[model samples]
Target: MKDTDESIELSKRMIQTGELCGKTTTAFITRMDHPIGNAVGNWLEVLECINVMKSGKGPKDLVNLCLVQAAQMLIQCGAVPSGTLKEGIIMARENLSNGKAYGKFREMVVSQGGDLRCIDKPEDYPRAQFKADVIATSKGFISDINALEIGHIGVMIGAGRNCSEDAIDATAGIWFHRKVGDRVEASDAIATVYTEREETLNSAADSVFQAFSFSEVPVEPEPLITNFVTKDGVSNFSMSIFED
Candidate 1:
C-alpha cells in the first residue's frame, strides 16, 4: 500500500474486511517515491529475487524490507514472542542466511509444478536483443525517482502489458545502478534499459533518464515502511529501529 492518508484509511477498511472473513491481516504501507529494488520488470525481478533468496543479499532496501515483512508474519503466526519484532527479524535473517528460506522455496516450486530450471539455473535465461544505459547528465545526489513514470517506461519497453491481451517480453526490463540519495557523476550509468525490440530501447532509455531528478546537495529519501496496520491498531515504525 502507498504511504498516503487515503491508503492508510483504506488499509484499515481492508483489515476489517479480513476480520469479517476470519483471517488475520496486517497491512504495511510504504513510500513509492522510487521503485523498491534495483531491477524492474518480470524476468529481471525474478532473477533478482532468486539471487537474494540464494545469497541472502541484494540491494539494502530490498533485503531489509523483506526481512521486516517476514518478521511481521512470524509475529502474527506465533513463531516469535509478541512485540518482539527485533527477535523475529533476527530469526528471519538467520533462516535467510542459512539457505533454509531458499530451500523451502525450491521445495514448493517442485511440488507445485513450477519450472525448476528457472530457479536451478537462471543463467540459462535469454537476454534482450537491445540494451542501453541511462547516463547521468550532471554531478549531484539523486533527489528523486518518479516510480510511476518509471513503470510507464517499463510498459513502453514491452516489459509489461498495456492491455490484458498484449504480449509481455520477459527479457525487457530496467536495472538501476544508482537509487535515491546516491551520488553520481556526469556520464555515470544510472540505469540500464533492455528490450527485445530495438525500436523501443532508445525511447525507454530517454524516459528512464527523465524519471530521475538530481539535487546539488545530498537528498534524504523517504522511509520505505511508514506505518503498520493490524486488527489492533496502526503504528508508525520508529526510524531508530532501522538505524545502524
Candidate 2:
C-alpha cells in the first residue's frame, strides 16, 4: 500500500512491476486491531482452535476470519467461482462441521511427533493447578481490551517468557469471560486466570483487570475481516451485503 505525502519532488522513476493475479494463487489476511480471539495463553488458544475445527464454533471473529480467508484462497485457485464467496464459506464450514479439518489436525500432530492425545482431550496438555475469576467492578460496557498488556501479563504469570531460553508454563494464561463489546454487571466474571503459582495469582489477575478499559457507551465492534483479496480483485467484506 502506497501513501501520498511527497512534498519535495525527487526524480521520478518507473520500477519493475510484478504480477498479482493469474500467475500464482496467493493471499494475505489482516487482523484488525485485535488478537484472533480472547485467549492469551497456549493451551487456551489451542483449545479454541481445536473446538473450531471440530464443531465450527469457537470465537465468532475467528470463525469468520477462517471462512473468509479460506474463501478468498479458494477463489484464487479457481476452486470456487468469482463473486460467490458464500459458497466457498459454506464449503469451509462444512469441512469443519463434518470433522475433515479436525481429522487433518490429528494427522498433522501425528506427523509432527506431537502427542495425539490432545486431539480430543485438551486435558492431556499441561493444566493449571488453580483457577480464579477476575471480577468486573463496574456495570458498564467493555470499551477496549489492551492485547499487548494482556500478553505482558501472561508473560508475568509464566504463560510466556522474555526470551527463547526462558521457560513458559503452557497452562498459565488468561481466558476472557467477557469479550470486547460485551456488557458487564458489577461483580461479573470478566476473565479467568489459570496458573500453577498461588502466590502470584493476585498480581496476575490484577494486571488482567487493569488491561480492561470500561466505558459508558456500548461498543459495536468492527468486523474482524475488512476485505478479501484474490486474483479476481479486492472485495470489501460486509455482513449486510452477505446477508442480502
Candidate 3:
C-alpha cells in the first residue's frame, strides 16, 4: 500500500478487525516529487545504491531518505522495535560510511547468481556511449528534484521500459551531483545523462534539464514521516467507516 496518512489509517483499521491480521503486508511511502540519485534502471539502480553504501560518493539525501523510510515502516509494523529504528538509521549510515552495506549488497547479488564484479567499477559497466551534461541556469540552492520527471527522462533514454516486453538499457541513466538545498552557480553541472543512442540522449537530456528549477532562496525540506495512526475502539473510530 502507498504510505499516505489515509492509507496508513485504513490499513491499521483492517488489522484491528482481524480482517488483515496474520496476513503479511507491505507498504511503500516515497517522496513522490523528488527521488534520490540519477539512475533508474533495474541493474543500474542497484549498482548506484551499492556504490552509495560502499564509497559514500553518491547523493546523500536520496540514500538517507530511503533508509529512514524503510526503518520507519519496519518499526511501525512491529517487525522491529521502535527503539531500534534510530539504531537502524545509525547502522545504515555507518555501513554506508564504512562500506559494509556495499559488501552486504554485493553478497546478496552473488547469492542470487548475479556477478558482483560488474559493480566493482561502474565505469566498466556497459554504457550507451552518448552523454550530455545538465548545466545550471542560475545561482541558488537546489529547490526541487522531480522524481517523475527524472523517471520520464529515464524512460525516454531507454533506462526504463515503456511496454512490458520493451527492453531497458541498464547503463542509460543519469548521475546527479546536486540536490535540494545545495548552492550552485549559474553554470554548475547538476547532472549527467547517459544513453546508448545520441538522439535519445539529446532528447532525454533536454527533458531532464528542463525538470530542474532554481530560486534565490533555499527550499524547505519536506517531512519524511508525516504521522502515525491506530484504531480507536472506545471512540468507535475505524478506517472502514472513512472508506464508506
**lDDT values, one for every candidate:** 0.89, 0.74, 0.67
Q: Pairs clashing in candidate 1?
A: none
Tens digit per residue, CA lDDT, model 2, 57-150 = 7877777777777776676578875557788887777888888888988999989999888868876766899888999998999877877788
lDDT of 3 by residue, 81-131 (tens): 445656556555665678776787788889999876787776676666788
Relative to the unseen true structure, what is the C-alpha lDDT of residue 124 in candidate 1, on a scale of 0 to 100? 89
**TM-score of decoy 1:** 0.95
What pairs collide in candidate 2?
none
Q: How do the predictions measure up, each by TM-score?
A: 0.95, 0.80, 0.75
Please tell me which model should have the higher TM-score, number 2 or number 3. Answer: 2
Residue 7 in candidate 3 has what lDDT?
Answer: 61
Q: Could you list the CA RMSD of all candidates, in the order they appear?
A: 1.5, 5.5, 7.0
| Predicted candidate 1 versus true structure: per-residue lDDT over 41-144, tens digit per residue | 89999999999999988998898899999998898889996558888888999999999999999999999999989888999889888999999988999998
The order of the candidates by TM-score, greatest first, is: 1, 2, 3
On lDDT, the leading prediction is: 1
